[model samples]
Target: MYSLLQRLRSLRHGFWYGVSRRIRWSRGAFEEAPARELCNVDPEPAERIAALRDRYQVQFELGMSAATSRNNYEYLDLLDRGWSSLGIGRPSGGVLCDIGCASFWYAATLQAFFQPDRLLGVEVEGHRLFRDGRARIDYAAGYLWRLPNAEFVVADYTRCLLPADLITCWFAFLTPAAILAWRLPLSLLAPERLFPRIRHNLRPVGLFFMVNHGPAEAALAEGLCAAAGLRRAGRWSSPAALSRYRMLPSVLSWWRAG
Candidate 1:
């Protein structure tokens, strides 16, 4: 009975995935504008928040809702702390690619943190709750419309990618259990292929940054990077506080392409 139920769920998800792709293609060009009202700030120390704002020039507002705004701020904080701890400095104008960027919740934070001349968010899944309603791609594009250099693409990272000066993958699914939990097709779980592609697309000396759920996943990811011949740059366990929710402390790691 359990096997049968799992099969049924997979079929349902597969059917919807095909339908969503067709709908997305038929929708014509996607158009978006900057969110009208950008008003939400983190309640961190005044000086710290101000310093971040001054450095990144990011307001950390999604303009979608207060909840999303707050979430963005939290991500911004995480990125700042993680990158600083790793001894990675902000990059000048260059290309950046973020893999597994579902809904691109941190699109603004990434744009501000890296200050990339071109920011591309790549995701394999573009599922929608309803056929006619908005999809994950819609949310990403809308949220990033304010940043002229930021764009999102629905594609498999293992199959295709543009060369980039910097690459980031946040909480990528490393185990089969993680993929099933997200209801993604099992075929999409291809760390072996994904890591190689990431290394190939990274320009020489370019940075590849990743964040994992905890020490276990971090170890798995580190091994993959090593197999791909990426030189380990730095690793740190983020200690930033995410007051909105509870979870295991995140582990951050970065590698440089030879």
Candidate 2:
């Protein structure tokens, strides 16, 4: 009698399990729409677009945000207090180039913040977002074409270009200083090889904003630039939202020899 009762319980569980599996299977059986009906494509442009589909799916996030601009604003606000002491004036319509500019958010903020006349943004990746001719900021997408005014290059980043009144290489450009604390070779070699080319592109008192994603990077940037004769114009840091919001990242901008 005990064995018979046990057999009946197993049967009951198995029956319900089978029924659940069938329901799930029924819900999951779906068919894709026909290609001709679902897609609107012409023969020529459609084929050209298809070739670009693979290229359009790339993404890079530099962890910059409006909060960063807010932080910049606050720092400037503080600086305003000591403008006389520092002998500083508001940044004017100077040509600025953002090397390794991703998404161009900070680039736009730069124009809004400092009111520079021409802003040059160079990134290795496709400039899908910033390339529209209608974009308020003058932008050239998909090329590292040299411009007489100011130039930004996306490749290797070791090459030289036109001089600038000010140059900003945000977090991405400067490696974390902590990395150097651990690895001295990179700390010593990289910044030196890259400096002469960069220094060659600066005016007598041109400003360089080397923003690093880490504190250690800030130290490295200072050391490297000082070694290369780029004096420090000003140094300050503000709390960043990247520490709060998960997606955002922060860096220290080492304004060199302005």
Candidate 3:
């Protein structure tokens, strides 16, 4: 009788285990969407894009968010044009660092455009709740594996210190709280909090590129620029031609260290 009862308990536990296995409760992982659907790519030499994709595996999605103008091929085009306008790659060879690089999409883009002497990316994984921490670790590692010229450090930007001739922040913001509460102001995010570290990390005459999600954040970025004692180089908003992108604020501002 005791043996029979023990077997019954074992069977019961196995059945529930099977049932639980069938039901997924975890938020799981970040889903990949087709890259073409997310962005408009101007006609470029096949070699260029092919090389980019091959190196970074940056198809399906551009960055952390696909919302509005946050993620797309047009963003890269805009960066290219903005860099050209700012004369960023002038006289050649310098280190380029991307803060909150996420998957290193922008880092790869900068490398291709500027051909920087060294490319470094700083990111803090599991910063968002949407994706699992393990997934983010894997993604960051994959980016480093594919881009031989690029190096990524998994550390929070607010504290991590890495030197660079150029540093860029693209849609990097504080995660909003519950719907009932307000979104954290941009002033409190890394751009402002890490200003001192950024100043220290940048080489003399180094540049910082900040792209805010909208006009409101642009105002905050301006304040950050002032707090850091950085001189404004130029500012550009989203172009009229990008109808979808225009919905977002899309302010691109450059600042130079003294």
Candidate 4:
């Protein structure tokens, strides 16, 4: 949806473009932002599930080692906005947090698309330029903690949301093969506990996306969701560009249950 040049320009100077007090806006955003908040994650069914990440590592995207992400609406948004970055977490309402949100490409995209609403992205590293004038996207750069106006928080797959409309995990899971390493080079030592956390974090029929890891990865992820009691809404596939680190070609999974 965006040419390379335009995307680059947007990235380099999106803050600049937004600097003018005369920033433009989409009429629908005011309506959509609030409505979307109603969809926050909940319903996976667990009263006391311990956190799964089990490790206090740096958030991936904002810096260098970010988790996987989509190349469709996300990529297209950045493409259109003229920026190149790690599109970390999902867009949720009501204290949203993209657990494991890396660079927060999605927040940037929302700023580009919606152009008005405030989006606070919590990461291990902060990245907000207030002078840019684009409603200063919040960057709670540090280990995840419950914060005000911070609807999201990055965590391990087994982590659950306090309460949110959406939870985006863009292929941020163990690989089929690497699933055996079980050390720092990997992610965590306890693999068995993670699935339960993923299941616990879901908001009943909340939405989560996975672009490509392979049929096996999809099936395993689906099974984990089912065990967590989340029903499958459907799966979708479409042509989109992926990050250099992205290995998937199409987003082949989706879910919703209430």
Number of backbone collisions per candidate, in order? Answer: 0, 2, 1, 35
* Candidate 4, 1-258: lDDT as tens digits: 445654454454444433422442212101111121112223331110111111212122332212211222344432322221223333334323344455354543333332323344433212223443222223222221222233333333344444334444555454523422211122232335644554455565455444445566677767766765566655654433333344653345555543
* Better lDDT candidate (1, 3): 1
TM-score of each: 0.84, 0.49, 0.64, 0.44
Worst 10 residues of 4 by lDDT: 45-54
Best by lDDT: 1
Where does candidate 1 stray beyond 4 Å? 1-8, 25-51, 130-132
lDDT of 2 by residue, 1-258 (tens): 225544455455445434433442212111212122213434553343333223322111112233343333333333332232445564567777666664344443455445566777655432222122222112332111222333444343456475777777765444423323322123222556566556667666677766555466677667777777677776655543223332333444445552
Q: How well does candidate 2 match the true structure, expressed as C-alpha RMSD?
A: 21.1
* lDDT tens per residue, model 3, 1-258: 225544455455445434433542333333343234434444452334444456435552543344422333455556755666776554246878887776564554566555778788886542322234334434555445546777776676778667788887776663222111222222234455666677778788788887876788688767767787777888877562332435675788888785
**lDDT of each prediction vs. the true structure?**
0.75, 0.45, 0.58, 0.37
TM-score, model 2 to reference: 0.49
Give one digit per residue, the lDDT tens place, for model 1 in 103-126. 787787887777789999998885
For model 2, how many clashes? Answer: 2
**TM-score sort, best first:** 1, 3, 2, 4
lDDT of 1 at 41: 39
- Which residue pairs clash in candidate 2? 177-216, 177-217
In model 4, which regions exceed 4 Å deviation? 1-95, 110-161, 176-184, 187-192, 241-247
Candidate 3: C-alpha lDDT:
0.58
